[model samples]
Target: MAFLPTSYEEMKQAGLDSVDFVYICGDAYVDHPSFGCAIITRTLEAFGYTCAILAQPDWNKDEEFLQFGEPRLGFLISAGNIDSMVNHYSVNRRRRDKDNYSDQGIMGKRPDRATIVYSQVVRRLFPHANILIGGIEASLRRLAHYDYWDDAVRRSILIDSQADLLMFGMGENTIIEVADALNSGMKIQDLVYIRGTAWKTKSLDSIFDDYIVLPSYEEVKTDKYAYAKSFMIQHENQDAIQSKMLIEPYDGWYVVVNQPPLPLSQEEMDFTYSLPYERTFHPKYTYIPAIEEVQFSITSNRGCFGNCAFCAITSHQGRIISTRSVESVVEEAKTITKMKNFKGYIHDIGGPSANFSRPACDKQREYGACAKRECLWPRKCPNMKVDHSHYVEMLDAVRELPGIKKVFIRSGIRYDYLMYDQDDTMFDRLVQYHVSGQLKVAPEHVSAEVLDKMGKPRKELYFKFVDKFYQKNKQFNKNQFLVPYLMSSHPGSTLKDAIELACYLKKIHHTPKQVQDFYPTPGTLATCMYYTEMDPRTKKPVYVAKTYHEKLEQRVLMQYSYPKNYALVKKALIKAGREDLIGNGPKCLIKTYPPRMVSKKKSSKKHIDK
Candidate 1:
């Protein structure tokens, strides 16, 4: 009764045999070219290996795995982009805090659901095929990580999921190397020397002083009760540069090669640009829950130059932007109209910071604007550039495509770059053809200091753009809205800053209910700041908001619509000496006094409450 197929017979009927490798899992929405599946597929094809993607495959139904044809399944690569916790929880399990709750408060612990289901199906269908497991879930859980959110140590994913191997980090280079080694007749045991890969080996007790050493799976799995002791040892010695110990039951040690970032050559860049993409909506699979259905999605560019603290795009794709030609983009649009389910509308055309069509500063210039860091808190590099002309041309070409009724800019346009336009032609085109019932923009934070910390534009610029957008919309009699995506409780935000931001939101009448809390994803500059409070290189303490209450207050102020936030907001405002925003004040958004009533009730029932 599951939503997708699960058996190998069903996979065979679906024409999966034509592929040399079958990527049977992951939940990264199956689009967005830089995702793990796309990267692995492209890499394998580059090395003469045929690949097919089965994104978010339904493991419950046995028929799903059967659809991919004969078991020519040379390898089974699992990026495991979907978090096991998210899949099992109705609420956000990642939001739980240990200080405020017990271990029982942890709601989702079914980490083996997807892996178990996929493993069973794969074994039934292709018993001899190799299966791999990886992603954020596998990486952090590779060793028994202290899950602060769960308040307990969990076993490594290798023991729980029984995957043949677990690949981690930006997996493109690792996956390609793995596939090439296996295809070249290299045994799994022979790959211990490759960096960034983990496998089992023999001899757990002997240790040296060079690599990250982990307890053998046999020792940890000997008794579930002994897990806590082993976890404590690992945690206490996490920073120790111990010599690598060989994993028991095998001849060699499990190795993780910390691979250096690979620079993309011009030829590889050109080849990626030439890959065939329909870029059109197929009615059968155009069911995206986040956005409404439409035809055409042009990839104007790839990669991002801005290395924001909270983003992983730069690490995954690198800071250099790889753009497709304007002509090629238009041709892709033309092909969309030929599809039987074509809707005659281009839904989105962009990549990371879509407006950055060309480099912000010239790449060839030694002393150009691109050589200077724009913001330091989140840490912007000196080489990032912003060019808008290529984007403008891309929009123009798509607009001129045959049978295209309307073109929308659903992908985010970096406001900082867009604000640099000396001419209004880009804005003019946006008004003319871009679908505009609502336009999404990420201002992230409104505090000047927070903005600097996040490597974002000034709050003043966002307001200016908001005013211009409204003015232009009114002139054209269009009822479009600029939906801003804001973040709360980043490294530098304080309660005072949050209250100020709340007052600003009220002043502008910007009541965006949807906001995101900082998640501290790995490899982000912001995360580094949050953890160490020091610049990575300088090793000096920096200003950061570390208290939980301060973070909570800031989050509440970001969404002042909540009833309980009234007292906290009042306290924050008073503490900041901004009594001007009390009740029904000029810049106050909250209208109710329910929190005051609750405070009075608590005072009156103090004797009875105990």
Candidate 2:
């Protein structure tokens, strides 16, 4: 099918007087399945509903929001693929100059909180219209939690936006149920009890008896300990088979969070990705930077099991790993090879956690992921099924396709999981062909204490993985490097820990071009630690580098090679009481004096070192 209506003219061209749903988005419209707006709108279209796109509407103009008029079913809203605040600002709370998801890499097209902003405009223009909010922003912020940008705990987006309902997690099936219910003449408020959704009511009298009551907005707002305790409960009950209905008390009403929907099967995945996508950005736009890389890429799976404390995939997409069939993936590959700009390359292959193409174990379906345990954390579970043979076979199939030169896995494959698998063939193949110079992996920190707090394995695992990576490179006669994505100032990381990381990086003769300071956005466990200053799991006090000065000090140590960061590094070294690291010695992190520079004089000195 052609791209969904992006303009009023297109809606009329499609012979529709009014669309069933008009999707307001924070991103420029792209019809690829990787984008949530595309999938949700397309899913609605597949169900015989006419859907139109109001992509990145000017939040200040009510007229722009009313281009498609009021919808027959309801208006669906999403903060694009990423949260808007994260899209518009940096971890340091600085406004970003460019937006990769915007048209021609521009910023400021959307507001600070695009989901809530867009919803307000929709409500103003269409007073009686039904509004449904979804996507990562709404999903993660559905409960009252920490907001890093605001530097405070903010109530649920549902309360702030005043939307009719909030859809959490991947909402393909639940959305269909919602639409069908509304289509059957049910009011939005009465359309409760749907899984993977949250709605507000004045009282809990109508709520089913089996539900877990979280700390009230009033208590959690005033008490950090209460918020931490509440997060642990929300974290544990995410499983489909085991989750209890969650209800949180706000001012006058209660926000009822239903149990998460079960994961989509392989067949559902195939059907979803098989939808006729334009496979690129909307035609009206001349360019969209996000498409250039993913245009040729294919996602083979959905959901993640990595359970990184800093990542929200578990809370938003769940921990169950579900994959599309190899045949479906191969077909997508063939289709890409025939595209207008086919370049004989497929950029990436996996989802939330790449290399995870199946559930952690066979029993995951009947019995939910062990409520209290992880599949590959603390130590690899003996019952955990680990193999890369299916991925290897799929890669082989794609690479064997006609007109295919390289099938790179740009989306990161978890290094820990790769090491857990006993087989070495996939590793060898990856080093030999899939890598495009460097393979990326997130070993967030090197300190054992910090790694433990991040829910990641210690330095020993990263060292082992690095050793094996280089060994495979040597065996395959490939010179590909390992690019480790590192983080700074995660809850437990101290100036001492950051210095230790810098020393390790120096020993390895590597300096990263970029470093991520822990961003405490909504529902992640790491965010809980950042906000509460306590580990939610044990409710034990944990040290946190909360001050911007301290966080900058930690970040400076990571990139000490830069001349601009030299002063900060020296200050950090001095402040952390590691004066031993300030001399002109191999063990020293920085010199006592700046490098000499020649003074520009009209008289004599040509190149005097300063």
Q: Which regions of candidate 2 are displaced past 4 Å?
A: 597-610
lDDT of 1 by residue, 1-610 (tens): 1112233544355544456677765442333343445545655666677665555555665565666654343545453544455344322344333210112223322223455456556766766666666555655455543332453444455555655666654455567787878878776646655544456544433334255444554544443333333433332221102213223221243534233233334345445545543332122343433123323565666556555766755534444455677776776677667867777777788876777565444642222222224322243334444346677887888887778888888878776666656677787677666845778888887888788777786777777888877777877777777777888877777776777777676665666555677765434556555655554433445566656666666777876755667777666667777666666666555653644444443322111000
In model 2, what are the clashing residue pairs, if there are any? 596-610, 597-610
lDDT of each: 0.55, 0.88
Cα error, candidate 1, residue 502 (Å): 0.3
In candidate 2, position 597 carries an lDDT of 49
Model 2 — which ten-residue stretch has the worst lDDT? Answer: 601-610
How many backbone clashes can be found in candidate 1? 35
Q: Looking at model 1, report the run of 10 residues with the lowest lDDT sum.
A: 601-610
Candidate 2: tens digits of C-alpha lDDT, residues 129-235: 99999999999999998998888889999999989999999989988999999999999989887999999999887765599999999999889999998999999
Could you tell me the TM-score of candidate 1? Answer: 0.68
